[model samples]
Target: MDVPGPERRLAAVLAADMVGFSRLMEADETGTLARLKTHRIELIDPAIAKNRGRIIKTTGDGMLVEFHSIVDAVLCATEVQHRMMRRNSDVSPARWIQFRIGINLGDVIVEGDDIFGDGVNVAARLETLAEPGGICVSSAVRDQLGERLDGVEFEDIGEQIVKNIARPIRVFRVRLQQDARSPPDKMADTVAQIGRKPSIAVLPLVNMSGDQEQEFFADGLTEDVITELSRFHDLLVISRNSSFVYKGKAVKVQEVARELGVDYLLEGSVRKVGDRIRVTVQLIDAESDRHIWAERYDRKLEDVFAIQDEITCAIVATMAGRVEAATHDRAKRKPTDNMAAYECVLAAKVLHHRSAREDNAQALRLLDRALALDPNYAHAHAWKGCVLGQTWVYNWCEDRDATFQQVAAELETALALDDNDSDVHRILAAVNLNREDHDKAAYHQERALALNPNYDLIVVQQGELLTWLGLPEEGIDWIKKAMRLNPYHPERFWNHLGRACYCAEKYAEAAEAFSRITRPDHTHHAFLAATFAQMGSAVAAAAHAAEVVKREPGFTVATYLATQHYKREIDRRRHEAGLLKAGLPA
Candidate 1:
């Protein structure tokens, strides 16, 4: 027994893990598992084998491999990362399958298809430090691979104190340069082409309150920061929808900037503990992966607005050289002095976006509490109108007529309280559009646009308004711009685009746009039927017509046309004819 010693050898270890594995699994367990299997069979396993590496073990979302050569380990990791980026090009950013890989060269103990020691442990720790779709290596690995790989560079992140490691380990991030044969990173190039003004994206602030229910508070804070920054017209701010895709994900600042087409990124966390709140924010120059500015504020909960204002001013000053008086004034304006009311509004907003019947009811209750706490809160009133309008539009309430009237009253009260709130004007514009008050809708739309030109909701509504005003081509352009402003925009934007295309008599394009929706609802089916009918695809039109009727038996061309706010009689008649031609009851 004394003569029997464990086999020991020097080896290069690689640890790789999927980013946001738990989140992806929770979203779609079956699909995620299938995709993982496909990736392993098609790309990962083959790459490791090709690089002369042997997989020691694999967990549900991660793997550990041993390589004879440090150069082989580095080559395999970098190759997989770049290939993964290409594989994810067609996938939504939120659903992207990205990997974080780490490599180290150290002595290891080998035992029956498994290896153990500081080599494997260090690699695992380094993997945790790697960004999604990135690779990190310890100093030993970096030294071994010096000048071996062409078009590859190492970025020194300095020493990192990793978990369970007694001593600090020096870390280096692997950066790959673009090859001449490869296609350009369009979003990365967009940063330079978007004009001289700097572009920035505000990622959703992390909720550090130790309670999942408080996520809305952090989200509200992040949105308020984005809104404040957007008021500085000199800066191009990415919309909330596009920026929020990175929420709760481990992302590289460079990857995020490339994806969002922004020159800068603002990321932070919110910790609301007891009556005190702590906010930590950092402004990063994405291209250089450098922190342009950073700050931490510890204040009472009541001083949250002041903290936001300070953060906004600091960022503006750091990026643009200075903040204007108007921008400062705008950032300093608080929606409500009552903290409880602001929290209520924040919670309500999260519920409203869920679009569930129970969530809609809960949102209304929260808004009621908000109004009760501060009746003069313009945002609360405006949000109350939005919720009621949702109820009317989605048939969530029993008394549709009464809800519609209440919506108008709440919006009117909100506008009177604070005419400067962009959201108030945006909601009012929507209400007026639904009521066929084109002139009022136009005025509010203009006001909303002027107040916050970067706001996606307002910009999209301009397209809707233009479409209804018989300017289909211009409406199409505006809609496309809105989509550009928020790449992860709601599916309804496609519906808007489809409708505008139909109005413009581009039936084929209209059909194509409608096809982009994963699950077409009854209204979507109706539009699709009309689009196909106009294109003389009678069979396709009839099939979609059947789907519409199956979903909503009472649906008819006359009733649908009656609800549409087409300013021109010709447009109305054209849509009516298409529906009838599609075999929809008139």
Candidate 2:
């Protein structure tokens, strides 16, 4: 009796090929072939057998394998990879036999111990996407083997438009353990990629001023120095949030270097007296824990900002000689003539970062005071707009329409005062996003990036903006770049990353991303709920849904969708469907 139709069943398909095999053979044909055969017989075959994966077929340099369990297939690939790494550890780089592997979980047509379908083609395409010694897997493979794969992390690489794939497939790079390799794809977007330029962190300057009220001045000086240092093309300045983690705590320079992953550390103290201001600064080699340079400046109070500029120029010249005129212009631009206004902005910035309602109110008041002192203060005006923009994000505004209008007005004034101010453009971009003005938002974002490419906040917002603009793949790259620039970035970065994951329809990755956030809010819980719902985990989805409602009782899918900034109607509909499945209020 003939079997009914062709046999079809879901299976894990793994495709792998040795990297540069042709070149290896061209260099040393006999030895290359012998080494390849020896590896297959000694390592690859045994690993496949142990993991219960069947070897379907093999070319001289590639193989297609099948497994009843996606987990087994992935495990086999990883085990083989580990053994290969150990075997090639002592081998010369030119003679190393690196393999790229790809796995997919899909329905396959079977006939007489052979299989063929889109599944195999997709796996082959994915194999080409991976690095010489890395693994790339389809989203389905990641979904099938979730957290069950211990010591492994599937970093979402976003939807890839591979050859012959009917649609873009969400792909993930499989990472084993803590050490991340510099694959070509990842290195392109990484700021700290292999052989980065000199990296430095400017620690918060200690306030040596007799009056406690002038502490803001000291903090402002540190921030200004950090900003000035960032303008230098050769220097990688750690973001303020990352550098300030050691504030008011006793710490060693080497410890800070280890924590922040920087090569240099700059420390200073600011002291103010009746008629004169004195500053002490020192640059330390973090790895050696030795002071490389030290300086002291005593200047009249009227020349405080100039003192900052001089100190910056000195540091830059010390770090890399021959500073450009444009660098001086960027480092020395005065925010406001009135020092009181500068202090007001510094105080408000601290409050703004807190993000609590009371803190927002305080920050708004300080920004108003700063603007009152100097109406043309572009930074103050920009921050005012940012505060208003946050009101919309955190649902703090009673009259959202009025708040949006006010935000637009403030940002416009800031732009008019100084178009080069990245913060002004960034705030305007956020305002445009809230108003659903996608093109304008993107334009402002591009301007922001142009003004300050290395600014962590601006860089990550580029990612967030792109994700909301229906280009999650590019957004993921930008966000990863931001992380690379600031290793100790704030927790909110993970939130943006998680949202990017969800936007790409990789729910398992999205849920894991949200879970890893240091502090999860209603939005985070809601995302987790939707992600779990997409994966058909009813219990997990219900639990996360409850968490969202528990945090905000009136939370509903409709309300949530209304607040989202997704440009495409289809994307919003997709998100809505997940929330609905999670039993969130419509």
Candidate 3:
């Protein structure tokens, strides 16, 4: 039996229950009830109401409250708990009334005036885990609050096995003392390292063209807008890796802002009809959940770059109150004037990201078409190198050497055409790293980071280079940062993290990272086997080892080692020993 047409929405669910309701009632029913009523009237109810919380229902001992904002929910809970502690100071410990609170941000099912779902259930379970006069929050609630709630501190209490919840929930305890601050987490540290500039993330634009094929166009437009916005060195624009994760998903701006650690967000849609395209963009102050500026552009498809320029300038002006003369000039530098070529590049990018043999082939064809249309298109040239490199890496091409040469030539041309292009530098860095040209890779990686500090591809490559440079711990951080930046990042990112962890001798962590990939190819299996072997899990090692040989019969430690670019002989030998212990061919 299912309820039809039931309303549902995302909310921060707060569940609170008295610590000793039964015992309190036994002590003095009338006195306890009166004191509870007074507390709610004077402190609890006012705090919830002030923070825009809707009290969905109230039991004799507890209440279920909903808040549109996670921040508000936590704020209300903390306020009530802090006030209760102060109010109970004069009372005997046995007579003091206390409520344990838990908060979770999740999607809830709404029926009449009540909400039902895992969101509410989890909050209730978390409430039971809270201390008598303290607050506990699910990771979702804590992440959504991320360094935003000043004077508040959250200590990660690790994962909790809550009843009725299949998966272990990561819970954080909100310290009753509001002014205490623990050391910032990695994500917070990364945001801080990026400087205190007005940060903004541009979400992928929705494709409203009534054609699924136009999705590439929408994504491309979004990327261009992000690139244009990134050119403003003064504005800390989040990379497409982080922002595009929200593509085709229903998300609240405040949640996105908190997760990305950005104060502002740019989001919109693209609708194309024939030769004309309509683009709608809005800049929002994520903290206030208010629109700062919005505009709709109806223009010929050829004028897409102009639209990007307008959007960039508008955002810069809105955020900084004025656009720098240099930034405004940079915004107008179009990638290419040829519309068909631009569209081809966009389509090719979508195909390239798919990372399949057929898709890579199709991407190459599109890139060729793009290059033919506009020979000087730097992005197209760089992307062609990327596709060719992928083909060579996967042995998709007939001649690996020839493909490698073409990749190098294309990247060189791209570099000559647009020395400032971040993709060009990013690709060059990757290419150099693959060939063991450490110094060249380092140069390009630095340049790429400078050009597009937040680009996920570049960020992850930094980790890759660091791993090869025998700095696996540092590499792991960059890879993880890239993963956070792009929650939907490519599966190969897991491979990168696993490799870094393995190099760092963190076998269990490496195994976990590698296991996150849904479809493990032969290479992934080989790494898993090696990781298991390192951890002395002989049975697990042998199983993954069998998988490796089953997928590639000629798999041998020698061949694999030859392909790997480990700067240190010790690291290289460690991988070799692991593979040997895993029963791979000598």
- Per-candidate TM-score against the hidden true structure: 0.46, 0.46, 0.47
- Write model 1 residue lDDT over 230-285, tens digit each, in one string: 66434678999998888999989999999888877888888888988877888777
Angstrom error of the Cα, residue 427, model 2: value is 1.0
Query: Which residues of candidate 1, in runs, are more than 4 Å off?
Result: 1-340
Pairs that collide, model 1: none
Q: What TM-score does candidate 1 get on C-alpha atoms?
A: 0.46
Residues 1-586, candidate 2, lDDT per residue (tens digit)?
9768888888899999999998999999998997787577546887788788899999989999999898898888887776677556535699999999999998889988889988888899999999877899999999888799777888899999988788999999998542465455534644232223457888998888877855777777778778766754345689899988888777888988998988778888888878878888887777667776677878787866676666554544444321222222322354534235555665666567666788888889878987876676778899999887777678798998888788888986776555556788788788878778898788778867766666677889999998998998888898987776555465778889888988998787788778877667888888888899999999999999999999999887887888898888988988899999999999
Error of 1 at 183 (Å): 59
CA error at residue 253 for candidate 3, angstroms: 17
Residue 323 deviation, candidate 2, in Å?
19
Candidate ordering by lDDT (highest first): 3, 1, 2
RMSD of each candidate relative to the true structure: 22.9, 22.8, 24.8
* Top-lDDT structure, candidate number: 3
lDDT of 3 by residue, 147-259 (tens): 99887888889999978999999999998763347544754654443214457888998999998866877887777667756654336778889887888899988988999
